[model samples]
Target: MNRNKSLFYFAAFFAMVIYGISTTIIGAILPQLIDKFRLTGYSAGTVASIMPLGITIGSIIFGPIVDRFGYKLLMFVASITVITGLYGLSSTSSVDILRISVLLIGAGNGIINGTANSLVSDISGEKKKSRLSLLHAFYGIGALGLPFMLSVFSSVVSIREVFLIISISLFLLALLLVFITFPVAKKNMGLPLSEILKLINNPLLLLFAFFLFFQSGMEGVAGTWITTLIQKTRIDNYNSALAALFFLILALTIGRFLISFLLKHFTRFRLLQVGLIIVISGAVIIFSINNYYTTITGLVLMGFGFAGGFPIILSFVGDNYQSISGTAFSLIFVIALSGSMIMNIIAGVISDTFGIQYISILIIACVFIMFFLLYNLNSKMSMK
Candidate 1:
């Protein structure tokens, strides 16, 4: 890759990290938010799910906009939205205002989620999947970083201040995007919406989207509820569980970087299969482990297992549908975000009724579904 391409990749990677942080910082601080608001488990999960719900709406619209406009422009707009949204989140104490802010954050996230990997996929030519995977590794970095950063300063500072810092970081990145150039989509160079919709129906792409829907749900289950689940466990205390969850995110971040190297030697499909297996193992371990230390180990394995799936699936979409990369990714994200929202709601309900301990079993089931879907996807792709 040329120097510009390398720079673009890093910029795109940072965007992913920022987006990840925006999405997850809430998860890290959700327990506190719930306490402040006096919210039930279901309500807290609903608030957490709200952003992805907005992202689902944005995902549906962004494809057409990106096709009509361009990635650079859409990305700038998205970053602006994120900055405004995060600032809004920091400014609000009302539950309704908080929900609206999260929605805007989701909209901003939808734009970045849809566009960044598509841009990398477009620019990297043959290295589409690998580039996309590396970009997502940065997301892991950001998601992991949020909890660790918060854990460091959480004792001394407030979550509102954290939102302010994240917002400022996003605004600066938005300013930087003004100087960067991005690639145009091939089909979107001139294609009509009708033609784009036809292309969006590609069976392979749809199947991948279907797989990702469940994958996103599984990932959300862990990301949103891990801290809460830990708090309910035999951990040292609520504070200790919160700290351990951050460590789990850190493990996930580290695992993604390590897997980036491993991807050079393995196919995305093989890597996904391995991830599903690891998740299942983690879930089972969660069931068996009685001690807090063993529980953290299980959670770390779960995090490591999940770290690879999104990046790999996204890279697969970009690699397969080069011309309609943005559209394809948007569709996949639409379903995935919807899945994230719906399953979180479900997890909330299940936890409310049966308690959070059962979340491990529920997550195990989702991973098994992912395993089946990936196995089928691999089989079909091979036959083709």
Candidate 2:
């Protein structure tokens, strides 16, 4: 890579890392917020759900913005919004304010994510998916690393202070992007909503959407339930279970980084097929085993398999249809976000009714759905 491209990649990766921390830190700090606010169960669930809800809505708005206005403007706006929202969250005591703050932060992050990935795809002529995977891997790295960094302060400081620090970091990054030059986005005159809606008629895109929907759900399930799944083994302590969850996420982050290197030598379909097989085997192991080591191993395998999915699929959309990249991203993200939201809710319901053990079963079932989608995708491609 040339110096300019290298710089852009680094900035994109750093930005993604910063954004990842913004989203995942909430998972760790939410319990503190709940205790601090004395929130009811339903109230807390509603509060927690606001971000994904905002992301779904944000994608709708951002797609047109990115398609029409270009990356730099959208990135600047998104970064400022998220930084401000985080600052707002840090200063707020009211639950209503916190909800609104989270909504802004979530929406900002979602827009930034979409814009950055779309930009990466635009620049990467031949190696689109590979580079996009690396960018996303950095996101995974931040998601894995930032929590541990935040945990160091959890015992010593308030969650508000943590958000304040994150807000500062976001501001700095936003300023940096403000000064950096980016390539002009292609002029798109299409109706973003109509273009996105039109993707439904494309069989491959529809099949890919289902694959991603299940993939996103499986990821959310693993993030939420892995600790519980490990603890149910009765051999590991809670600390170990938590460690397993981090390991799983770290594996995913690192896996995407490794995939960037491998993409030069492999086809997208080939890599995806191998990944699905690994995920299926991992799910099976997780469901059948009660041992901690085996469970952690299985989680890691599944994480690695799932790591490149979203970026690869998004890049695929961008590569195939230049005129409708924004619309494609919006539609695909809606499907993925919906699956993530619904599956998370389902995991909670299943855990409450059938016990936490059923979450692992649910995850395994989602993996099967992934298999079915991938199978159909592969078949269709083969026939083509």
Best by lDDT: 1
**Which RMSD values do the candidates have, in order?**
2.0, 3.1
User: Per-residue lDDT of 18-102 in model 2, one digit per residue for the tens?
Assistant: 7677767555455456577986434544565666666666676676677776677777778888887888778888988998988
User: How well is each residue in 1-384 modelled by candidate 1, as lDDT tens digits?
Assistant: 387787788778888889888888667777777887888989988998997897887787677677667767778888888877887787777999888888999998888877776777778876766666677778877887777767777678676777777878887788878887655545545557686678677777777887888888877888888777777667535567667777677777777777778889987887888888888888888777766778888888888888788778877777677666667778888888788898888989988998878878888888777777887888888987
| Best-performing candidate as measured by TM-score | 1
Segments of candidate 1 deviating more than 4 angstroms: 185-190, 236-238
TM-scores, all candidates, are 0.94, 0.87
Instruction: Provide the lowest-lDDT 10-residue window in model 1.
Output: 182-191
Error of 2 at 71 (Å): 1.3
